[model samples]
Target: MTTSEHGAVPGLFTLVLHTHLPWLAHHGRWPVGEEWLYQSWSASYLPLVRVLRALAAENRTHLLTLGITPVVAAQLDDPYCLQGMHHWLANWQLRALEAATTRTASGPSPASAPEALRRFGSREHAEAERELVEFDAYWRHGASPVLRELIDGEVIELLGGPLAHPFQPLLHPRLREFALREGLADAGARFAHTPRGIWAPECAYAPGMETDYAAAGVGHFMVDGPSLHGDTALGRPVADSDVIAFGRDLQVSYRVWSPKSGYPGHPAYRDFHTYDHATGLKPARVTGRQVPSADKAPYDPDRADAAIDGHVADFVDTVRKRMRAESERIGRPAHVVAAFDTELFGHWWYEGPEWLARVLRALPAAGVRVGTLSDAVRGGYLGGRVDLPPSSWGSGKDWQVWAGERVADLVQLNNEVVDTALTTVDKALARAAAVGAPTPRNPVADQILRETLLTVSSDWPFMISKDSAADYARYRAHLHAHATREIAAAAAAGRQEQARRLAEGWNRADGLFGALDARRLPVA
Candidate 1:
């Protein structure tokens, strides 16, 4: 209902990058949050940071629309995580060394194994090492300091969300309000910006969640285009909230993760599966042949460079065409926002950075304006009134992926734990509010709030669903359950001392979200 900066707005093309992972520093080693963090750091964060810096150096604006969940942000700042990530980076170099030596030994034409190993220790290699060290330092020293710089620099438009990535639709509706309000308050304090929008976990949307969003002071929210059911695109006000629903532009998003296909599956890219047991690298043909690691072709920068050009050009053409047609059909300027997880670039697809930089630059050259989601809402665009459906931007745009039979128990348990935690916190806060005018700040209430958010994290069930490290997932759920239990015991027994000690322990361990106070809930 309110457009804060309507005059200077450009037609919207939101490039949202959802960034998250479960608590992973002390978890198991592979296939879930820990590995996911390492893989994404190397493949996505490092390179994406490179791309952002490059674009900034050239003064290219509207560079990114990024989402960082609180739990993931917490890990990125943890000292333990910094050490683990550094070791992983060093080990990756060793892996390259092992792969090169084994491949050369089996080659028909001798490869330069010494040359490859030398490259690992060379100046270029040292430079890469230095870059990661600096990047990691930025995150560890205080992610908010660096992240705030990016936001204030106008290089990006930051998006905020619940403390943990929760599927709001299925969450107890009362807690949805609790989560949303606390998330924004925390992010605003850290980043020094009151975000006008939210990237709902999995882009999940339910019909009445808008009230919670409105209560939280979010202006615009996102959902997959299909989730609109039959609604309009620009965005629409939800009841009395003044919060608007901005649907994803499926025309553009489907290029990366669709029902049947995506460019990442192209044979030219490094295969995600079927890594060599001998060399610990993916060196075989992904589709047809049982090509051995030794026989597979080496990665040629030239081939990937050429592919990037073609893909970028194709994307630009596609976007330009879509914008023209959609504008004509709607009889207004169509805002096409294409969103994706930040990890997909460079992490899932090695050549993703090149593709992204090219696409971002190409959009403007082709007369298709690119922007962040908030930019669109600020531009005064409006949608026909309609309610969104219960949907997520998962494999099926439904909850099936996270709530299927395979992971039903985990999902069901998560809902129960989250609901219980919220209920306990609500009661505790109500008592706190009644007894005293309020302390300078309520750290106890904040700790309880922290426990509540950690328990509600979507990552646990998601990790279980992927079937990667179910044990770690189970362990984490139990860990959060313990925290939630601590809150319940403290509230009931009036053992505020025990609650304080446990809260301090979590503070010593994971202190990011432990700074919230329920008394600061926007004056209720």
Candidate 2:
């Protein structure tokens, strides 16, 4: 085995985190919508960014690849969301304080108010207070400047995707191409750095997308290990295109967290499903997978911290073994790319950010080379060319999760809405051209396109399929579809005044991509 001066292993390891969420602002709040945004911001985005910045302070470079979809980026930079998130953090602190103060008037009964819960509340209150202060000081301006700083500092590589997180394989080729270009342009405008790689929403791929990616100047993307027919140790060129497709190593990636098992399932970690209903706080530990939330053990930070250290060491060992075995099998240095949703870090797995920081720091000491996906490509870790099949990192490793029998209706709805919106915009453009009017500046057509794109988000179908929040997902999909239909109807009827009114109304709710113009809609 080859070794560095420190006698570390000789292999490449890349960590990729895909960040995305559909248009949620002005949609709903309590159970879903903007709440999802704020929770992720507080739990995942803020902490993960802090971790990277800390590493950067020590001159860590090419740490990992971060894919922030255009839609999510738009929300992060939005003034409305900025204000909403700040208020939400403040409220979170208040709720924690209330939880801490809850007590029985009759006596100091343990059942009335548990000591563990009070302690948890105190911890949460302090954390929220710190986060609130940080938000006002750094994030009041929006997430773009902060993210751009990381990119400029060489701490992370930004991976840009299409405007909305649509399943590209199922989308019309014209719309897919249009979304890809517009999405990259949006990222460029925000970060002043256009990304050459993307996370390929859901890691979904179909034939001929390589050509489209090449045309759009995309250099690399990701797919599941099965997409490469189980050989995913290195990046592979796809279908005669120079654009590289990096397959996520399920063995190593799942070692951190997976549906069946992972570090998060340990008994010491915080229980994700369980919560104290009265205070909206999770005070339970994952005592057992089969145990109900109420029956789980009270959470203890000391136990969780111990578990984090154990998992981090186990993860480092897992990576070392995989790298050595793969290198020997291939008779050269091999790369292992472990990709996960950014939300998994803190939102789903409370110890995720800490685990991430520890793993990134520990790997190098163990002789493993860690870098972003781009670094692997640049370092010549490209494997042989292979024809990738239609696949995703979802259940069944196929298109079933987003377009299966379970969500057939959503699939149909997406097709119908996209078709109607595109046709309406096309007809309006033709009429405007005939009448010597400005077609590109039509606000009604622009809103139609925006609402239509939002309707086609892959999150709706996945959510419905998983039954995590089926009702909310369905509501969001239909809500945007209704907006698209009404805007199109008004525009097609030549009711300019009515169309403008409807467009303005919808824009207040689903107005993410301010630069989204109907003129960018691809001709079909």
Candidate 3:
């Protein structure tokens, strides 16, 4: 255990935002694919970046620890995605204009409908226009340079993760290692810096996983609070390795968003689900859970702004109280980590970014020290070593979400696909070695590995289990599985031409991590 400059402060707070989405490039567009990516980019990423850039201009360093999984990084930097996102932004501007001119029949009177739409359209148009400028300036080329700028400026600490955000604990050892190593390399390729820490997909863990982290040159990662058995006073070294695991402090994190209640559910906030189909905009406030979309009140920016203010102050007070209490209980200053999906702000909860900005500013003013996970580790906010249990941040804080009966078929599918892909790749490597090839960069083998990794991504099973997009999840999982199977079978059967053709097609659709090489897969 160790202490640091924060020993005198009540507690130190670190905000972790895990930014991830499965590879949606060349996938479906509406309802559940690239739309997810672009919507998050325009609503969350753009605004979040705007807020961070503002803070960075003010010279705020270590504002938070941000994890941009390699898969998401690949999309953000892909030429196809950049083009699509630009078009999406332009479409948004067009939608706003349409909304302003389109008459609706739901308002108090016929006259009221036009007035309401005009106001909504005008406001949305300006917001979309601002996002467009931001996109052209910082995001035209890709998100890499923008992200790298923040990283280099020390505005946030970037955390890397596996190539496709696989649930690590359920993955094969060799593949797990390969993904992590490749993912980190991918980050370095984009941002020019390899992250020392990772927001482990799902905050999933298993005993001795820290050894994997240590072997991969990772100094720290995250896990769930329950994995630490609720003793989240500080980051803990795992097992005998020097790798640290920072557990999320549910006490502080749940205050912003939780299952039953959170700031976003407040009536003043924009209703995420209530949409104006005619205009393709959300036009209602969360009047009440029971209120129908038709009966819900129109969203008012002033009310939402007031709600954000109150929530921000309340959150700051919550952190202060939590830190003070934890510090007194532990006989020293404590550390609190609040980890959440980055999309929750600006995407799911419309006012989330504003609330986050206010909270970040208010916390320091209220005397709560803020830092990144790296800062916490270096500041010596570490407790005794702990042998972590197999766990995830999923429901019940266990591996059931990814491996449960609800996804038992998916589990089997993943196993079968991975086995076939690995077997096929291994044979390809052996053939290469036999042919006196000096390098292991087999294109067919690479595509097999790529499709295989995408096949087993934790996102599919999660989406299925959560029922958010079960059919789409199953479709994607099987789509990749089928791709891997066909490619692997073709290669394994000595049908080199057929395998190459299949690989090329899949590569065009699922191509990501251009640097991924099957030959580089770690040997156990």
lDDT tens digits by residue: candidate 1, 410-450? 67776776666556656667776687776446565566666
Instruction: List the candidate 1 regions with Cα displacement exceeding 4 Å.
Output: 1-12, 94-127, 133-140, 230-233, 274-296, 402-408, 415-448, 494-499, 506-508, 518-524
Query: Where in model 3 is the C-alpha error above 4 Å?
Result: 1-8, 106-112
Best by TM-score: 3
**CA displacement after TM-score superposition, residue 470 of candidate 3 (Å):** 0.5
**Model 2 agreement with the true structure over 144-178: per-residue lDDT tens digits:** 99999999988999999998899999997878888
Ranked by lDDT, the better of candidates 2 and 3 is: 3
TM-score of 1: 0.84
lDDT of 1: 0.68
Task: In angstroms, give how far residue 366 of model 2 lies from its true place.
Answer: 1.0
Please state the error at residue 310 of candidate 1 in Å. Answer: 1.1
Model 3 Cα lDDT, one tens digit per residue, 317-435: 78878888988888988999999999999999999998888877777777788999999988889999899988999999998899999999999999988889888888888888897
Clashing pairs in 1: 43-346, 43-347, 235-383
Q: Model 2 off-target regions past 4 Å?
A: 1-6, 105-112, 435-440
Give RMSD to native, each candidate: 5.4, 2.4, 3.1
Between prediction 1 and prediction 2, the one with superior lDDT is 2
Quick one: best lDDT, which candidate?
A: 3
Using lDDT as the measure, what is the rank order of every candidate, best first? Answer: 3, 2, 1
